[model samples]
Target chain A: MNVKVIVRGKAKGAVLCAQKPVNFLGGIDKKTGLVRDEKHDLFGKFIGNKILVFPNGVGSSVGAYTIYSLKYNQSAPLAIVCLKADITTASGCAISDIPLVVAEKKDYESLKNGQEILVDAIEGKIL
Target chain B: MELTKEEESALDGKHGETLALAYRILVAIGEATNADKLIPVEWAHLSGVNYNTIGDAGEEFLSHLSKDAKFRIKTTVNPMGFDSDNVSKFHLDEEFVTKQQSIRNSYVKMGATPSFSCIPYEIFELPKNGTQVSFAESNAAIYANSISALKTNKESAFSALASALTGKSPHSDLRDEENRKPNLTIRMKTEPADEITYGLLGYFAGKEAGSSVAISGTKGLDRRSCKSLCAGMGTSGSCGMFTLGEEEGEKIDFDYKEMARVKDELNTSESGDIITLGSPQLGLEEISDLVAKLKGRSFRKQCMIFCPRAIQGQIRNLGYDKELTRAGGEILYDCCTCLTPLVDKENIDAVVTNSVKGAYYLKTSNGVDVNLKSLHQIVEEETK
Candidate 1:
């Protein structure tokens, strides 16, 4: 299906879908790529090299730096797919060179956690 | 999103890695918001100064970027973790001081003005109305949009920095006048008697109305009260701009009961260890007003008054600094009551403040209780 490309790249991995918006700053461990926020449904799961999916970003703007730190530590996700792209997630992926795309509501809802998918943000498509 | 030749070159890394990165961020944001094109901005005010807020990641990133990046337009910064001049007096940790100093040096190297004041609207002369600027500080963004008639989206730290480097912002969101109208209306049922009440009203309104809001029944708000409203609204949610008038939309009533609920949530302590002021740093006018109010009175507890250093020099010239000092008020420059290490949990259990923004941060970020009160009530009861 067609999607909106934010950062251009190609990535393929299993999906890790978050039901709620994520706050990268305090919500995830920069070094470990683990969801540390106790309130998150994806808590105790590692996001390393996986295709992370969420609605959007919330909380502090410093979440951009956390995304960079995740990359610097080599613990970043392979790619990100969201229903909407907020400044925090968009800018973070842009600077970090991570593949990012905004999928349609039906396309995003159809994908389940642990489902394998390939995201080609350069061509703005999902397969 | 269409890009000019220069923009395309920058995105392709012809200009340099820093500019390329900056252009990349702008392009991403523009695509996400569906902006037609890029527009030039006159000013860019940045946040993410406090070491507590940005941490080691930001410190390292900034230091690396400072090697070649310079601000393309007028730029200003927000407060740091502590007062640079009074570092010895505050007894801060050595590592924190070093990291904070590195962050300061990075911004300086990038050609940003060392304003270090959150209320850049008061300290610096504003550009003409309708001028587009990038302000990352939430309170400053709200004030610029709602009060000064300037145009801006509530920019993020990295996004504003990108604008500073490129002198360009996406022509979207609040920057366009068509999107400036209110989506919701908040009718003040109870009279906003003081700045705290106005603050609560703003907080409640922002939570209900995510973007722009029209507020009726609030009139004649002084600079202090307006600033309180901006700060309160900035604190609660992603809501950025608020207009003071009636509008056609879903209406919410801000009655006395609603005010009491917000106050009850913030006012965790009946008493406090210290009295703190200035969540959005006070201006010369506010400082003068405070001096007049404390003319013959002395505070019974330790009072910390935060203001900009430029105004500090003015207060010194007017000899009001001595009056405040004699009245047991410690004047702190370049830092406010929120997210500051000056009021540590080890030394103090709770703080008394007249700012709703201060109360929220002091409780959540600084790890202390708050005794929320109005400026009038604080002066009447805490002074002798």
Candidate 2:
């Protein structure tokens, strides 16, 4: 089964799931695109070109620029899929030109790490 | 989203690529939030200035935008990486100073007021009640919405910058009258009498409300206490606007149990050698109060206060700067201690502050664990 969500850009990639909220500013490394915070469950994993999934963002208005920085460094995720989109994540994805979609909690909960998911942002669908 | 004729022209590339991009970003955000149209804003306050916070990519983006772009409306900026006048005392490395200056220079070139403090509400003459603004810093946005009665969403740096360039934000959430009313009521059975207590109350309220709320049953809060509460709630919750003494919505008791739990959770420091203040820049009165508290006493640990250059000038003129120096403390400018790298510097193992946002950011942004305490408590423990 598939669900519809608010989509900003269309992209396809494998899923990299994080259960906790992300603070992109210092939480992720700009150079390597790896989650730097030891406390985060996805620690040491590179996020580049994956369909990154998190519950939401936490901390720092600079989180917006970190998204842009990730893209500029060629290390941004192919797309972001959040259960609920906060303003920080929304602005980050909007400015970075990264495909982003906000989905229901049940739909997000159904997603598994490493599963190939299609983010059809133009039509606002996840299949 | 519907765009006015001028906005459509800008979208059509009449206002150069910088503004065209700004307009497009605004349109995209507006659509996402279901905004029906774009509205003009009188002021824009930007965040994401500190080099430590934004790093190289942010520097590149700002420099690129600032090259040909100028702010169409009055704009103010958040703090940068270090104190410009007291760079020598801040222990900032040469590379950090250079990058910080570059960030400052780019914004200055782009026509933003060199107001390198987060507390723009205190520094700038805010627009009248219901006047729309585009503000990025959480604390300032909170103060604007709750205290000043101005309207603004909690904007990100990108949206705020876009609004500054185009002087328009998508009309949604906070702009509408219906969304401003409090849906929940927090009746403070015990008044939040002190600034620090207000901070805790706000932190708790935001956690519980999880949305717009009205605060009641408390004695009238002074400006400082109000700022503290707004900042606290904004940091912990998504809602920025709150009303005090409003007679609406489901009411909850703010009793001793809630206060005790919050105090136990927030007051976590056992030993703090580096005491820091000013999450939002301290007002002149706050500085004066600190001076009176010091009373020529010396400190066992280093006490640091953050403010902008203008406030530092006032501190000097009033002779409090010298008094602070005598008490093993000094006032630094051009950055907020929360956003700067000063907290992570050597020999600083523990930190004490009164701001929920300050403690949260210091841990998240710098990885420095902090304990929340009032200035009075911090002063008593740190000073002789």
Q: Pick the candidate with the highest TM-score.
A: 2
Docking class of 1: acceptable
lDDT tens digits, residues B1-384, model 1? 788999999989999999988999999989877788899999999988888777777889899999989999999999888888888988899989999999999999999898888899888888998999999887899999999989998777888999999999998888889888997889888764688988888778766776689988886589988999999887766677999889997888899999999888778999999999898888888878888887679999999999977687789999988998998998888788878888899989999999998987787667799998888788888999
Q: What shift in Å separates residue B277 of candidate 2 from its native position after superposition? A: 1.4
Can you list each candidate's DockQ?
Answer: 0.45, 0.50
For each candidate, give the interface RMSD after superposing the true interface residues on Cα: 2.3, 2.4
True contacts kept of each: 0.42, 0.46
Q: Residue A10 in candidate 1 has what lDDT? A: 97
Instruction: Please report, in order, the local distance difference test score of every candidate based on alpha carbons.
Output: 0.86, 0.80
Query: What tens-digit string does per-residue lDDT give for candidate 1 at A21-122?
Result: 787765787778888776679898888789999988765565777787788888899999999887778888888889999999999899899999999998
- Per model, how many backbone clashes are there? 0, 0
Give the docking tier of candidate 2. Answer: medium
The runs of at least 3 residues in candidate 2 whose Cα sits more than 4 Å from the true structure, single-residue gaps closed, are A1-8, A26-32, A36-46, A104-106, B12-14, B189-192, B251-268
Model 2: per-residue Cα lDDT over A1-127, one tens digit each: 3433333577888999998788787589876799987778999999999999998775556678888888989999999888767677777887788887777788889999989988987788887
User: What TM-score between 0 and 1 does chain B of candidate 1 receive?
Assistant: 0.98
lDDT tens digits, residue span B1-384, model 2: 888888899888997888777876787668656689999999999998998878888887788877888998999999887787778875777888888888899999999999998888887776777899998887788788888888998788888989999889989877788777888898887643777778778878877774368898767587767878887786665677788885565888778898878777656566666888888778788889988987777878777888777676778899988888888886778788676787773667668887766776676566676777777776787789
